[model samples]
Target: MVDTGSANRRDDRTPVLAVAGIGKSYAEGKQRRTVLADIGFEVARGECVALVGQSGSGKSTLLNLLAGIDKPDTGDVEIMGRSIAAMGEPELTLLRREHIGFIYQFFNLIPTLTVAENLALPLELNRIPSAVRRQRIGDWLAKVGLDGREGAFPDELSGGEQQRVAIARAIIHEPALVLADEPTGNLDGRTGNVVLQLLAHLFRDQGRTLILVTHSRAVSEVADRILALDNGRLTHDTEALSW
Candidate 1:
């Protein structure tokens, strides 16, 4: 028999994210290569989980799958008990817009938009009322320590500041799950720690589920659980991990 990865515990409350028997493959010439196989795990509501591994471990691919940016070749990804495979691109886009917040390594901010406008873009796309959007933008900007820099364009901000803006834009809508792919990869140790702490603390205070991908041991230590992504699969999961 083959091992089916691992799990922590099944809390009575519904999981914010669940992946069962997930597998992915791609064609290499005339043959197929498996990227991930038999991946399974559950992240409880309000839990912060880290997916850690070396490069080429398929960690980012898994993030894309979970965020509904790509489809799995097998098994299912359920966010809030809804199967992501059952939705189309439009629906998946809306789902992400409404419930998922994504942060990237390079801080993908719109260069043409000021910090304030960029932060307000998602709210406007979601059709949040103008008054409410304004308030949320102001609130999150301050929360992320970007209040005074709101009028600065992305190109005008420093690396750390740009990342803060990215984070502010992500959580402005109070997403249920925040998927961060190497959110601090571009920062130096000091700045990286600050960004990591801000992300972790925000999730903790809001009771939101967070799936963060990082290779930094210090970063993973902050999570409620540490999940290993190996050979494109979730091979191990440990709760309340301490170095």
Candidate 2:
């Protein structure tokens, strides 16, 4: 049976992510606005966790903190066992480049880049050789069901197609952690379902840790654990971890 309550470590592996005493706030003119306060959790390696909450529930804020895109006002975030708070900007950038992948709510594909070019981007940024990049692009295109549309521009493709490209691009380099923010929010029901399945299958097959911020029940259904945030704190966590 699967261990949803704690890290499913094979031996002595560490958790993929650990958020401790996390608190984040913003200034709305004069007073401070607390977006997330004293929130904490750990995501195990190879586990898929769904973060769900009503709109304006600090979900995105928490995700940004996890990705090191935003700093916590009080507390620390650790990814792959490294402290996000301790890293300088250059170090953080390298950490993100080497270990993280992201899928945005709106498919953030560069309009000028073709499907193949977009998928080839992460590999290119990591300085993968041209020949190996080409091979991976071809493979990922087929994996995401866009095999023959490699040269097509973003505008030429449908919403679902663009998202497929996004998914393919995000995982092409096999980052240890993948952060998806409302990945299927813009697609129709059927199309969204297809994309979600692709995400789960590919992540599971590759043994990557996935933390998805979503409101869809269908998305949460696939996760090993479901966490809910309210106002600026974690109000509910199903399957609490023992460690």
Candidate 3:
């Protein structure tokens, strides 16, 4: 969430993404492994929520389902009241492209594309005017402190810098929801903290919704609410302190 003004925050206060009774399972040879079951939550617009759990828990799976990247075997996901299951690929693609931004722990920049090119990819795909896209690219670059390094390739950047570029790419369109999967998992603690702080600042400053998955308590503490997952179920929900 960016520093949304009071009026903007109020306008975006309604439930933007809702999840209910989501369950997913996959067969492992002859045995079925349940990845998530009956997990339910809602992320309000302009809010930051964290889902924390040990490995094998369903944090990533749940995030994927909510993001419309994966279908749930059972349960319904409603985004701002629309049924996710009812969407076809085109509708889903539109929903994701326009309303959702995803951030991965490992920066997944295109190896061959420069930082600026990567950031503009989504907007260009959506057919935004070049002038608007260029301005947005510039704004994101500035926000992430990479104004002059946009020409650099992902491999030329440090891990933290790479992740920052990833962040810029994610938020350039100002999506209603940002789903982050272990956004800091690949970095050192110090670097990870810096990434987390950047995320926190974005949520606070931009007023976009964030649903982050992390195992670190330090990361979870920044969220307005923390959802703990275990063995494919959500086990805990706590409201953490705000910035």
Note the Cα lDDT for every prediction shown: 0.87, 0.89, 0.87
Q: Mind giving the per-residue lDDT tens digits that candidate 3 earns over 1-243?
A: 676697576656658888888899999999999999888887777889988889988777788788887999988998866899988989999999988888998899999999989999889877889999989998888888888998999999999999999998888887888889989999999998998899899889998889989888899988999888889988888787632
Clashing pairs in 1: none
Candidate 3 has its poorest 10 consecutive residues by lDDT at 6-15
Please tell me which model should have the higher lDDT, number 1 or number 3. Answer: 3
Ranked by lDDT from best down, the candidates are: 2, 3, 1
- Runs of candidate 3 with Cα error greater than 4 angstroms are 1-13
| TM-score of structure candidate 2 | 0.92
Scored by lDDT, the top model is: 2
Measure candidate 2: CA RMSD: 5.2
What C-alpha lDDT, on a 0 to 100 scale, does residue 44 get in candidate 2? 87
lDDT of 1 by residue, 1-243 (tens): 543342223333668899999888889999998888888899888999989988988887888889988888999999888899989989999999999998889999999999989999889888999999888888888788877777899999889989999988888888889999889999999999998888888878888888989999888988999999777777678874553
Error in Å for residue 175 of model 3: 0.6
